[model samples]
Target: MKNQVTTIYKQAERFAEITKSAIVSGNIVRAKKCLALAERLFATGSYETKNAISNVYVFSVSTFMELRHCNISNLFPQSLKAEYLKQINTSGV
Candidate 1:
């Protein structure tokens, strides 16, 4: 469990970095892909690791959306977010 948590945390960190770059480069597709992967990985981490990664993911994406004059809340529709989380966690993709 400890090793898995550490591994997931590190992978999520790298994904968050790529996500930030994608956001800056205007590569929304890549950003979303990485974010989705991170979300999937979020399923297996320890509670603290999950919260840290969640903060990074939310802040990175929300900031990008804010800069684009988008409503941060629109980043993910509540229903869609729930559905995707369910699907990704189950699919283990």
Candidate 2:
């Protein structure tokens, strides 16, 4: 479980970095590729457990918002934030 969490976090970070690069370089194709990579990471990790899925979802959404320079607070509600926080705290991803 720990290994899976660590691996997903690393991969998500890498994906975010790639997405950022794609955005800065004006490469929509590369950005889409990064988004696809992120989706795959979420789907793969989510298959391991429900908690993992939720965490990955949060990470992906947050990363996307960050990449696009959008406000996270404006995107999700407090309930979803609380749930995601619970998953994050317990899952360590």
Candidate 3:
């Protein structure tokens, strides 16, 4: 179980890296695949392992949102929505 969790963690990290790279390279489809893989690994891993890997998921999602021209802060609504709206206005997308 320990080894499995370790492997999942490492793979999740790699997936997270791949996701970021894919987004930066404008390969959103590949980035989505990587994010899905990372999420699966996180779900299968132990609690502590998943906890450690959570940031990888967060970063992956952030990259995806950025690629989509959305702000992470806006995802929560409230005042953050204004921030995202500003970005949208300035980006002209």
Q: Which candidate should be chosen as best, given lDDT against the real structure? A: 1
Tens-digit lDDT string for candidate 2 (1-93): 653535555555554566666666877677666555544555454555334434554566565666678654643445445555664568545
lDDT of each: 0.59, 0.55, 0.56
Clashes of each: 0, 0, 0
The estimated TM-scores of all candidates read 0.52, 0.43, 0.48
Off by over 4 Å in 2: 1-6, 46-93
Ranking by lDDT: 1, 3, 2
TM-score of 2: 0.43
Tens-digit lDDT string for candidate 1 (1-92) = 65353555466566567777887797878866766666655666678766656655555555556677854344453533554354336654
Error of 3 at 10 (Å): 6.8
Candidate 3 RMSD computed on C-alpha atoms after optimal superposition onto the true structure: 9.5
TM-score of candidate 3 versus the correct structure, residues matched by position: 0.48
